[model samples]
Target: MLKGLVIVCANGCFSSMTEANSKVKALLAGRKARQCCELLVLESALGKGGAPWDFQRGSDFSNVDPFAFIVLA
Candidate 1:
């Protein structure tokens, strides 16, 4: 099985880690993918150096497609 911690972040921002994790889990609750991946949230506001608020700034996905599929080793 492909089990890993899927760290999710918003194009905007989330206030807390708990809130981010819960919201993502709730959104994916009905999906089978949720069963294999452990959901996590990147608390941009609390991280070191912080994260960019604008999606176009300091973001790798700024010019990419709307969806992404990542696998962690």
Candidate 2:
């Protein structure tokens, strides 16, 4: 099966690690992105809840399309 993978910027900078973390939180918080291909916040998501799901970063997440995964960080 093909799983969806997204790259979230959570380093605070645009497309950074901070942004990635935020996007993930937004999604989990029920804040859907209004923009198409909106940048994801990966850090915030990881902050809110420990990864009970099978989500991986820098390995399975890298090299994949950002929109492909539903990250909540």
Candidate 3:
């Protein structure tokens, strides 16, 4: 891993151990409430207002949702 490859954010990242731990707990506690919402967000089937997997069919995000892709170390 690289030194400057880590990023800290409100949703929780490697910036703080406490916040990062909390984020993990949330995920493990079946707090995946955003699963459906996230899938729909990436769906360009209806211009980002549809429902499905990510927009990898040569399309752009219709409604850009502030998303953060995190990796735990």
Candidate 4:
């Protein structure tokens, strides 16, 4: 069973978070309580090892883009 939804944004931007949150909420509208899951947002630096997964060398997130997030359920 899904208990939560996590949004991991590459850059910590308020606008990005807000947009993602709204999208998630819209998607969950009209769902039953049990079907709906808690939402969480996390800020990370993808090229700086902020994420647990490994990335290839030379990857650049120097200028992190807006609204770049990974959804985990």
Please, what is the TM-score per model?
0.40, 0.23, 0.22, 0.42
Task: Put down candidate 4 lDDT per residue, 1-73, tens digits, no spaces.
Answer: 6788776655535456667677667766775843767878765544333534335422556644433555433
Alpha-carbon RMSD, each predicted model? 8.6, 12.2, 13.0, 8.4
Number of the predicted model whose lDDT against the real structure is largest: 4
lDDT of 3 by residue, 1-73 (tens): 2222222343322455555656554544554443323211111112323344466632566644434333334
Error of 1 at 61 (Å): 19
lDDT of 2 at 42: 42
Clashes of each: 0, 38, 0, 0
Q: How accurate is candidate 3 locally (lDDT)?
A: 0.38
Model 2 misplaced regions, further than 4 Å: 1-14, 30-73
Alpha-carbon runs more than 4 Å astray in model 3:
1-12, 31-73
Winner by TM-score: 4
Kindly list the per-residue Cα lDDT of model 1 for residues 1-73, writing each as its tens digit.
8766756454345555566667777777775877776655443223334443466643755544333423222
Ranking by TM-score: 4, 1, 2, 3
Task: Give, for candidate 4, the lowest lDDT window spanning 10 residues.
Answer: 49-58
Candidates in order have lDDT scores of: 0.52, 0.42, 0.38, 0.57
For candidate 3, the TM-score is 0.22
